[model samples]
Target: MGEEIGSDHFTQDDFREFGERLARETTLIRKLQDEGGLSDVGPVIGLELEAWLIDHNFFPAPHNQSFLARLGSEMVVAELSRFNIEINTPVEEIAGEGLARMHASISETMRQCASNAHDDVDTVIAIGTLPTLRETDMSLEMMTPSNRYAALNREAMRSRGGAPIVFDIDCCTGAGEDFTTSYQDVMAEAATTSLQLHLQLAADRMRAAYNASLLLSAPLVAISANSPLLFGKPLWHETRIPVFEQALAQPSPHQRVTFGSGYASLDLVEIFEENLELYPVMLPVCADAPDSDFKCLKLHNGTLWRWVRPLVGKSSDGKPHIRIEQRVMPAGPSVLDMMANAAFYFGVVEELAEYIDAATAEVPFEAARANFYAAARHGLGAEIEWFGKNRRRSVVSVLDDLLPMAERGLRRQGMAEHLIDKYLSTIAMRLASKQNGAAWQLAHLERHGDVHRLTADYLAHQKSGLPVHEWAI
Candidate 1:
C-alpha cells in the first residue's frame, strides 16, 4: 500500500471530502455481482464520442450547452469545454458488423445534432485537437459549470499547484533530457476536438478488459495520432493521453504526477489495490447528498485521475455502478474509425478471456508492455515485439498478424464480415499509407507554419467531415 511517502499525510482515503460515496461504490459492486448477475459476462458493446462545436468563423463556440439542450439528453451531453459535446451509442458485436453498427449509430447522432443547428451560429466537427483552441479558451470562465467540474478543477489547481490546461510538449526524442512528461501530457490532450469512444464491460471482466486497454494504448494512440502540435510544435501522434493526464492531475504540491504503477496486472483487483495506494480521489461527493457509505478519513483531499480512475455513481434506477471509464481517445476521422478502435480492444479482451491459458501464456507480458511504448512512440510505424511461432515482430507486422486474428475473433462472435472489414481495413490503411492524424497534422504545420492558420484549416477539414485519408490538404 502507498502508505504516505516519508512523513507525508496523504492516504487513499485522504482524497474524500465525504466517505459515503466510497461506501456506495463498494456496496454496489457487491450487490450488482451477487443479485444482478452483472458478473455473468457477455459483451455489452457501446461507445461515447466527444466532439467540439465551432461557429462559422472557426472560433470555439460556447453555445454547446444550448445546442445540446436543443438536441436533448437522449444522445449527447456537454463536455468541460464550451466547444465540446459527447455522443454515445450502444455497442454490438456481430461477426464483423461491429464497425458499421458503431459508425451508423454515431453518424446519425451527429447528423441529428447538425440538423438542429441554426444558421445564426453553430457547427459540429469531429477532430483530434482543435487547432483554433487558445490558452484563453480553456480558462475557468469558459469551463462548464457543474459541481463535479468545479470541484475537480478546484482540487486539481490546489494539488497540481497551477493551472493545468495551458502547457507544452517535449517528447523523449527531444534535446532536453530533463523534460517533464507533464508538459507533453498537457499539450497532447484533445484540444482541437475528437470523437472519444467508451465501451462497456461486464463487472466480472473489468480487470482483463482494463489491462487490455493499457496493452492497446500504444497502437490505439499511434494509429490515431491526430494531435501532433501543441500550441504549434511537433510532438506525439496522439498527444491527448499525456495532455489529459496532466490537466486532470489534481493540484498537488509536489512533482508526483499520477502514474498508477506502470502497466496494470492481469486483474482489476491489482489496479484497484495500486490505485487505492498511489492515486488519490479528485472529486468528492456532493456535500448535501444523503447517500452515506463511509470509509471515513480526516484529510478530505486527494488527486484527480483523468483516464481510467475508479468512478462511483448512482444509476437511473438509483443503484450504484462501479465501472472504469476509458477517456484517452480523440474524436475521429469518422465514426467507423472510432468503433474499429473499440473492437480492437473489446475483441482482444474477449480473446484473452477465451484463450488466456493458451494465448496469453505464449505472449510475454513485458513484450506487450514494450509493444505499448513502441505504439505510443511509433504508432502504426512501431515495431511491436510479439512472441510468435517464429520470433519477435514489429507492432506493424504483429497487427498485420492480428487483423486476421481480429477477423477470426470477431467472426467467432458472429460479427459481420463487412462490419469487421470496414474498421480493420482502416487500421491497415493507416499503417500502409503511413497517414494518421498526427502525420497529417505535422504535414499541415510544415506547410501552414502558423498555428492560427493550422487551426483554421483543421476547422475547415472537420466541418467537411472527411477522413484524414480522403482530405486533399
Candidate 2:
C-alpha cells in the first residue's frame, strides 16, 4: 500500500482484467511453492515507522505536503492523513550490529525529518495514538492528497453500501471512569499510526515464521501497548487495535484489517489464495508489468491489512521472495523503544519457530486470535493462554518466561551478544516495571495531569531518547 498508484478511478474492464491477471499470478505462486522455486534470500529485516506531524501546541498539523517536499527524501513520505508521514529504513542483515544499525538509521531519519519539518509543522512524533487528537480533526479535509487514499476511501465507503463508518468503543481505565463513544468516517483510521516491522524469510520457513508471529502477537501487543487514550477517553491499553479496525469497518469479513480469520495450514501462498477468493479488488488499476511482478495480487493483498501480513517482494536480482510484515506494535514513544520491540519480536519468533510442532498441536488458532485482543484491551495486565498450561497467564509472566528463550534464539542466530543484551534487556526492564507506553500514559493521567499536559510530557520523553518504561510521570 506504500507504493503510488496512477489513478483513482477504474472502469469495470479494469476489474475484469485485474481478476484475470490475479488468477494467473495466484496459479504461478502455487506452482512456485510446489516446485520450491521461491527465493531463499533472507532473514533480512526492515522497519517502517509511521508518525504524526504535530504543531507546537501538540495538535495534528496537516502540513505533510510541504513537510515531505521540504525533506525531499524518498525515505520519508506522506501517509493516509497529512498529519502523518512514514519513515522507512533500508533492509539490514540479521547479524552483528543489525539491531543497533536499525536504531541508528531510524534516529538519523528522525533528525532529517526534524531538520526539514516546515514552519507549519512542529515535530514528527511516533506514538500509537496521539492524546491531543480530536474527533473534529478526523475529517476528509485532513486526508493526504493522494489518488490511492481517495480511491480507498471511496471503495471502503462503497463496500459499506454508503453507510457511515462507525467507531463505537467502550473503555475502562481503573484510574479514569469508563467511557463509550461512537464516531463516523474513515478519517478516524488516520488517528492511529503504527511501527510495522518486516522480516524476509525463506519460502520453506514462511509457514513456521508466520504461525509463530501469530502466536506471539498477544504478548507482543501487551508489552508494547502504547495507544491507551483516543479522543481523550481511556480506551483499551492499545486502543488503536479496535480504533483502526472500526474506522474502516465494512459489512463483509474480507474488507476488514484483521488478525486473520484462521491460521495458515499450508505455506504463505495460502494467504494469497484466500485473498483471491474472499476480497473484492479494491484498487484494480490495470498494470503494465511482467507475469513475475504479480502487481494485481500485490495490490489486492495490500488491501487486506492482516496483523501479520504475507508479502511477495523482488530481490535485487529480480527474483521473488517472501516477507512476514509484523503490524502489531505502535510507532513511538522512542526510537530505541521501537528497536527493542523489533528485537524482542525477531528473537522470540526465532526461538518460538523451533516449537511450531508442539505449538500447532497444543495451541488452537482461535485461542491465539483471542489472546491478541485480550492483550490489546489489557496490556501487560492481560492474561493470555500459553502452550503448556491450559489456564491463562498474565502477559508479564509470558514475557518473563520467554526472555531467556529470546536471548538464546538471538545467540543461535549469530547476533552479537552485546547488541542482544542491549535490546532484550529493555524488554526485560519493561516487563519488570510493567510500564510500557500505555502504562506510562495512564500513570500520568492518574497523576491528575490533563490530556494536553500528558501529550506534552510524552513528546518531551520521546525527544529525550529514553524508553517509555524509564520515563517519569
Candidate 3:
C-alpha cells in the first residue's frame, strides 16, 4: 500500500485485464498453499512509525518533501500528507534482545530525522493525532504530490457517488463533543498517524494467527489508545481509529478500512478472494511481467485496508512468505512506549493462539467487533468480554490477568529476560497508573489549558525516551 503508481485513472479494459490476472494469481496462491510452498520460518518482527513535522507554533509544517530530500535516506519516506513522514526499521527475529535492538534502531532513525530537519521546521514528533492540527490544515493542498494519493481522493469521492466525504466522530473525553466536517479529498485521513507492527508466520499458521489478531484487537486498542483529540476536540482514546475509517467513507455497507467482517474460516486465500470480489481496483497499473509473483493480485490486496491485513512477500531465498500486519496501534508518545505496545501484542498473540477455537466459540464475532469500537472510544476504561468468560470485565482487570500470560508467552519465544521485563513492565505500570498516551494528553490539556503547549511538552517527553506512563502533566 505504501508503494506509489504512475497512473490513477484506469479504463474499463484495465480493470478487466487486472481482474483476469487477479483470478490467476488467486489460483496460484491456492496451489502454493496445497504444495506447502509457503515458508515455514520462525516469526519475524518489523515496524513502521508515522510522525508529524511541526513548526515553532506547534502547527503542522508541510515540509516533509524538503526534509526527506535533504535527509536523503530510504529509511525515511513521504507519507499521505506533506506534513507527515514514515520511518521503517529493519526486520528482526522476535527473541533475545530483539526488542532492545528495535528500540535502538527507532531511536537512531528518529535522531537522524531530527538532524536533517529543514530550517523552517521546528521538529518532527510522533503522536496519534497532532494536538495542534486544525481542520483547515487537512485541505487537499497538504496532500503529498503523488498520483496514488490523488487517485485515492478521486476514487473515494467517486465511490460516494460524487458526494463530499463527511467525517463525523462524537465521543466523550473530558466533555462531550462532535467533530463534523466535510472534505473533497482524503487528506483528513492524514491527520491520524499509526505505529504498524508486522509479524511473519508460516503459511499453515497464518489462519490461526490472523484470527487471534482479530480476537485480541479490543484489548490491544485499550492498552495502546493514544489519539484522544482531533482538531482540539477531545474524542476516542484512540481517535485515529474512527477518524481514518470515516475519512475514507464510501456509500457501501462494508468499509475499506475495517476490523474485518468475520474470522478467517479456512485459509489465508479466503482473504485475497474477498479482496478480489469486494474491492474495486483503485490503482489498475498494468504489470509489465505478471507471472508467478502475482504483482496484480498484490496491488489489489494493498488497496483493501483491513485492520488485520494479510500480506504476501518473498524471502531472501526467493520463497514466498505470509505476514499479518497489525494496524491498530497509534504512533508515538515515545519510542519505548511503541516497543512496549509491540511486545504486548507479540506475547499475547503467541500465547492466546493455542486457544483460538475455544476463544472464537465462546466469544461471538459481533461481540469482538463491538468490543473493539468500545475500547477505542473508552480506552482502558472500557468493559470487554473475554474468551472463556461470559461476564464483562474492565480492561484493567483483563490486563492484570493477561500480563502474566504475555510474560509466559514471551518466555516460550525465548525473548530476553531483561527485554521482556523492561517492555512489559511499561505496559503493566501504564495499566496500574491509568496513564497511557491519551490519558496523559487529556490530563495535561486539563491542567495547562493550551494544546500547543501540551504538544511541545509531548515532544520534550518523547525526546527524553521515557515511556508514556512516566510522562508528567
Q: Give candidate 3's whole-model lDDT.
A: 0.86
**Tens-digit lDDT track for model 2 on 386-441?**
88765578878889988998898788777899989989999999888999999999
Q: Model 3 — TM-score against the truth?
A: 0.98
- Using TM-score as the yardstick, the better of models 1 and 2 is 2
In model 3, the number of clashes is 0
Q: What lDDT score belongs to each candidate, Candidate 1 first?
A: 0.55, 0.86, 0.86
Residue-wise lDDT of candidate 1 within 216-283, one digit each (tens)? 55556666766654544555566565566555544433323332444444444344334334545554
Q: How many residue pairs clash in each candidate?
A: 47, 1, 0
Q: Every model's Cα RMSD, please? A: 6.5, 1.3, 1.2
lDDT of 3 by residue, 271-375 (tens): 888887787877777678755887888888877788889888886657888789999999988898899999999998888887887888877889889989989
* Lowest summed lDDT window (length 10), candidate 3: 386-395
Off by over 4 Å in 1: 1-17, 20-24, 27-37, 91-99, 118-120, 161-168, 171-195, 200-204, 250-259, 262-266, 273-278, 286-325, 352-374, 389-393, 448-466
